[model samples]
Target: MGKVTGFMEYARLEEGYEPVPKRLKNWKEFVIGLSAEDSQKQAARCMDCGTPFCNNGCPVNNIIPDFNDLVYRQDWQQAIAVLHSTNNFPEFTGRVCPAPCEAACTLNVNDDAVGIKSIEHAIIDRAWLEGWVQPQPAAVKTGKKVAVVGSGPAGLAAAQQLARVGHAVTVFEKNSRIGGLLRYGIPDFKMEKSHIDRRIDQMKAEGVEFRINTLVGDLPKDGPAAKVTNDATTTITPAQLQAEFDAVLLTGGAESPRDLPVPGRELEGVHFAMEFLPQQNKVVAGDKLKDQLRAEGKHVVVIGGGDTGSDCVGTSNRHGAASVTQFELMPQPPEVENRPMTWPYWPVKLRTSSSHEEGCERQFAIATKSFNAGTGKDKGRIKSLTTVKLEWKGGKFTEVPGSEQEWKADLVLLAMGFVAPIASVLDAFGVDKDARGNAKASTDLSGGYATNVPKVFAAGDMRRGQSLVVWAIREGRQAARAVDEFLMGASDLPR
Candidate 1:
């Protein structure tokens, strides 16, 4: 340990955000990163616990203690190296990951946990600024071809790993841009697209090819819709991908949004979080979207308390909404988890996101009864919502008597989370799916990522269902190893 008693000496410090008034004016990253000295002190607080549960706590199994020591010792280069060993994109996780590692930290038994995420953010950003991040091309090409569908974190991680192992990896994205959800589904204010752009450049230099606007199923342009690519006539099909590539890995995200079937769901102002988020990201990317979904001067009601819902609140704040309110069916959780019982595991507790801190009226234990859209002038537009308190008994949720109420709501966003991967893409490939609609594949080493369909593999949200970005990266990296081993008899890539 760099400083044996550093944990006792230094308290945890986290990055602050710009003032709400100043930050709401624009869609940009508002987090003020910790200074170098402060970051070092934060790192020094990492106690030399015999068992570093933070490593296992992290989805990607990040080498937390090693990097902490490296940072404390002023070894910036080594810190970045250790950090990148497990995570392909620390910048993404550092900014958005809930930091379960902190929950599992031994020091967190009583006092504040070490500021691991903040230190991680500092290391990666510093590495980029110092030009320490570079392309690590394979020594020689293996003459093997690998097709990775979807360019999300999972796809990107797999592509990078395969490319490093001498495989000719090609990442195909259906979108106009390379990044799948990262470029679209996430708001720009949470994470700028520039990080994805720079990583794309690094991957390109490492011999990984990127195909954008390449819809693999029906061929967007030539079939029914207009051509997606500029002046491109031909479109690629799933069958074509099966025949052209040596092995195929499905790394697409779970895009099937959970819909609200209640009345007024089809209203003009009602929308899925995916639809609303991507448009903002596109606008941030310099592509103007006509009639962008704005919550300006309107009562914005976001359903669901997950990250997507928080994003809606943040975006609405930027849009200058008349009022923002979020609803969660579940009751509000305790501010702090009972760590003695829940140690080393993610516990049920309240999580206040940066967006939540910005502003929003949050309500829990309340369920929306129905949309109160009158047959008046506002026929197709939402006007108000009828909600009531809920009671759980005998495995059923019942509405409380005399608890019904109506609230003004001009715009509503459903951010309840994705149910499964879009069935169309899975059906197109004829890939077997689990009961949950995720791709059927065993994670065993013998079979690796091989699905029922030979040479077809699945990873990320496609196989595992909806999950965090870090888990997606882990799956992608592991899938890459499985693919490599299947192709070349054995693989040296890390799991």
Candidate 2:
């Protein structure tokens, strides 16, 4: 709305990236954010659509048009204020969220959508550089204690909101570090760890205590689910939390990865993506690791075509793998979606991430049959795997006859995505679970986020299953409001 006709005058400007050759050498953010002038031009492209669907399209319902107008007018401080008013961590969403807001933009119906994510990146990065981001401690204390189990986006968002509302909040993390998924799951090439560190510092200044390496519930001593990253030295039970805190929020991620239970799955080098990813993250954080899973000089095969699989591709390339190949069970989507039919909604289209661009041979509609072990000296280690092509017919996949094949694979990383949260934590709390194994909780305004168990709540991936970080933040903020109302009988915090 800042420039009525600007949308017609300007073409979309995409963010730049470092050359693949130079970026593959180190683990660091490679995106080149838009300059102020470029960001202003991009923001000016926002049209005065009668109903801004982008607001609702965003999981946190960010005030998109307002921030766009502010950026167009070169109001940097105001832009960040609008951004933070909705999203607790624009740096995380700006870097990793797959901009559903842009997909719902009015301009996207006929032309390129506004570069909203890039503008957000510029705003937050600029705000940090200008010292606009600082601690916002409460003036008065409520003396009520709240326990947040998990330190990912959802837990962090909820803790910040409750702390700002004058409640004493303590976040418990099982890992040695604060950030659960953001610290270990995401590669540094996508987003640096320093972003999470600064936010932790700010939260500490706001009176939110973070207890790292603290497990609030029991975890399986051994199993596939046990492979989840955990370094807890202290374990607290549900009864202790219920007695000590006025409210308990379960915000842990969906850590139970889906497995391929084919023959020879027990072979060495066939590991879950989590098992391989966290080690590299620790190594990047300067934690020396022995027997680290390295892809160097190995034929790597990453199963599942998703963000996690793409991340594996990037990491494998960084490790100087001999070859990297990715497999997808579903058929490849169209290169471009039919905008006329799917306007104002997320569409199914082929996506090529930066990791895929680096180097990866991707195969679609392929299913693994079994992992094959090597012979003699290489016994017990995976050497290759059998696969079969599939054809979709009558809503079912029928294997193609005579299409069986074997491919060399010294390392097989299963990244088929997480199935649910670990069940032990919910069992410890005696919280009910949905059919999908996620904590059973509603999002209604009345009694929202409350579990069947008394004084216990659930949100984020723990409640909604695997989802975007933006959605996690939204659930966390809303859960905080719900808890506030439950504790005080009313709340003024924004949903």
Candidate 3:
């Protein structure tokens, strides 16, 4: 978009990070963003292909090339404007998004893709520093009320959009603070909570009401909510929400974690990723708890190779773990992908995260047969994991005979992905569910995001199952448009 041959002339410049030894000392972001000149050079790499597949690759449909061109020309003000036109929280995605757009970059066909994410990070940070990011409360009030259940990315996005469009939007969160998983499930090291707090402030300025420590739907007087971060003893019924608000939108994300049904699963010292991650996030925020979980001097075994598992590994290292090991059931993919076959698409290949760089052992194609309970000196806790090698054939895994092994583990965290939204909430609202247990609502343009129930709608993980923040944002924005259309004859809001 800048120099015709910028891609050929300039090499990719990735963000820098603090050394592992230094970064592990605290729960803070360590990635140093690209400099202005470096960001401009990287933006110049954008070929601005006639058909930009990166636009489609991004779930939010960000106008990537336009911003890249703007940044390349050092039009930083217009760059931020263009970025905000599509993305409500580039700051969130810039830090946490896996950058699928880069994978679909036209130049990625046979060369290093344009550093789209780094440029996005640069644009948003500069916008904040220059005081360009500000609230735009509607000039006129619509007198319409929308009740948003959940304070996760999807709920927050929908609430912000609706509030900006003059709807009285109230966001319900059960946690003590807002930002849902962003404030709890994620470690502060990957992305500090300040980003979410600032956005919350902006949203509040835009007239969005945030009811923290208030549950929208029912929660058992005592349930898994305690294990997570539930501070409110009060609950709001679905009927109350539907009756009070002109429209109701469900964005309460998938929270039903996939469990490992094996022997000794109930043993002490075994936990879910959400259970482990939130506690540390709270600790970093200056919260204290009795018998807080720590990995210090313990052999930690994290049972999943996804981002959540990687977070566990990094947190353990910070806790001064004696050793750490991660397990993945699927066989490892090649270190590099076949560009010709997988061009313009997310490729299947080995991905080593920054956390893996700290220090940890990784095992692939391994199945956990059971958890071995420790006794005697170790005392009624998880002592080891019994596993077996697997042979992948015909889309299923078959255990290899006589390939059993068990390793000592003082603590184990299950990092398997979530299955669906909390069942009670959906049931309370009487919303239909997909086979996967997510709320059932078609994405068809004619009646997109609407539930079978009149005046009620659903979006994000609650409807689509577990997904990235970008996808949640897209759903939230689209659902807002749908809700706006339903409230009026039609909507001027972007779809």
Candidate 4:
């Protein structure tokens, strides 16, 4: 779809980042994007593979080759239009998404894949700079009201699509701000909140109403606390929303984080990654935190080796921690994938994120056995941790004998991952739940996204489980189509 032989003529070039020392000093984005010429040349590498596996790899089914071709032809205006046709927030995905599409690119079989994400990032940023991005309000109002509970990616995408298609949409956010995780769970250095601010402005101009700091139903009482930057005092019942709106979409994310049940878990120096991350984000947003979970001059240990754990590492480094270490219970993956076996599919391999590159020691196949508080006035605060090595055999982990050791630890952050959506809101809406405790709904075309309640639907992490931002956007768009069809007897919206 791009220049026919461009892939053979040119090599790949990655995006740039600021120096570690300079970027660590402040909570701001540091990744420098591709130049116009660089992006155009990269786009020209698209092979026009007859069956684009990239579409399948991407949850949103982005028309990758067509957009690449458009960019190569210097039609920047139409490039963004084609992009927006499938995804609501390219800017968000461009910055934060792990590009599965690139992995599935045709060139990836024997060469570097087309820089699809970089192309996308360049397209949206250029569109924004050129004033090509604007609100597309509905030509006619449908006289139907949709109450989207949660302001995360799914809710935002659904709200925008429904609003553009003429539905009166009201977004209810438990947090004081419009963006849910985008505004709170994510750190500012990774993605500045201003991106969300601009999108919210566009959504508002398109006739969407936002009710921030308004909690729907009640929060789950037990679990690794899913902390929020929003200081919400307002509460709205499921019954009130059911009565007021013609349709309701439950897009609240998976809020219940998995916990570590062990000795000294209640120690003052130990906290969940959410608790630590949200506080830093709030502080970066200029909110004052009272004795917040600072890692300065203290040994910090993060329990988990995923993005959340990486985020903890970056944040702690920024706080000037004495030392930082990350532990993963599972064995480490190979540095590179075997392309022949895993072509066009996500492969299990070691990934080093930008945060990992900043500074931190990583340990694999290790498990925390216990914790201890030294004898002092701060006896309830953790001062040391006991851990053990593990061996994986037959899909089970067995502790290695004589491998137990103890180390000094002043702070600990639990980042194992999320297990379920907060049970309270789903229970309040009377929506059935899957075995894994997420809101249950089908994805069939006829009745997809409909919850047990007649007019209530569910999507995103709240309905599925913990996943990438791109998946959440896909669910939101699909659920919007389902809601539109249910309200209008049929929908012209994309599925």
Better of 3 and 4 by lDDT: 4
* Candidate 4 structure quality by residue, lDDT tens digits, 1-495: 658899988899899999999999999999999998999899989997799999999999999999999999999999999999999999999999999999999899999999999999999999999999999999999999999999999999999999999999999998768887888778899999999999999999999999988989887555554353447789999999999999999998887888898998888888888889988888888888798889999999999999899999999999999999999999999999888899899888999988888899999999999988978796888999999999987879999999998878999999999998888789998999999999999999998999989899999999999998999999999999999999999998998
Lowest lDDT sum, 10 consecutive residues, model 4, at 221-230
User: For model 3, what is the error of residue 356's alpha carbon versus the real structure, in angstroms, after optimal superposition?
Assistant: 0.5
Q: Could you list the CA RMSD of all candidates, in the order they appear?
A: 2.8, 0.6, 1.3, 1.1
Model 3 misplacement above 4 A = 220-227
> Which regions in candidate 2 have their CA more than 4 angstroms from the true location?
none
Candidate 1 stretches with Cα past 4 Å from truth are: 218-234, 374-376
Error of 3 at 168 (Å): 0.6
For each candidate in the order shown, give its overall lDDT on alpha carbons: 0.87, 0.96, 0.90, 0.92
Clashes of each: 0, 0, 0, 1
Give residue 414's error in model 3 in angstroms.
0.4
- For residues 1-495, what per-residue lDDT tens digits would candidate 3 score against the true structure? 677788888999999999999999989999999999999999988885799999999999999999999998999999999988888999999999999999999999988899999999999999999999999999999999999988999999889999998999999999888988888877899999999999999999999998978887665444443355677767888889889999999998788888898998888989888888888998899987778899999999999999989999999999999999999999999999998999788999999999999999999999898888877976769999899999978978999999999998989999988888887788888999999999999988878999978889999999999899889999999999999888876888888
Ranking by lDDT: 2, 4, 3, 1
lDDT of 2 by residue, 283-355 (tens): 9999988899999999999999999999999999999999999999999999999999998899999999999
Using TM-score as the measure, which candidate wins? 2
Ordered by TM-score, highest first, the candidates read: 2, 4, 3, 1
lDDT digits (tens) for residues 216-276 of candidate 1: 6643222211211221234587888889999999998888778778866667788787777
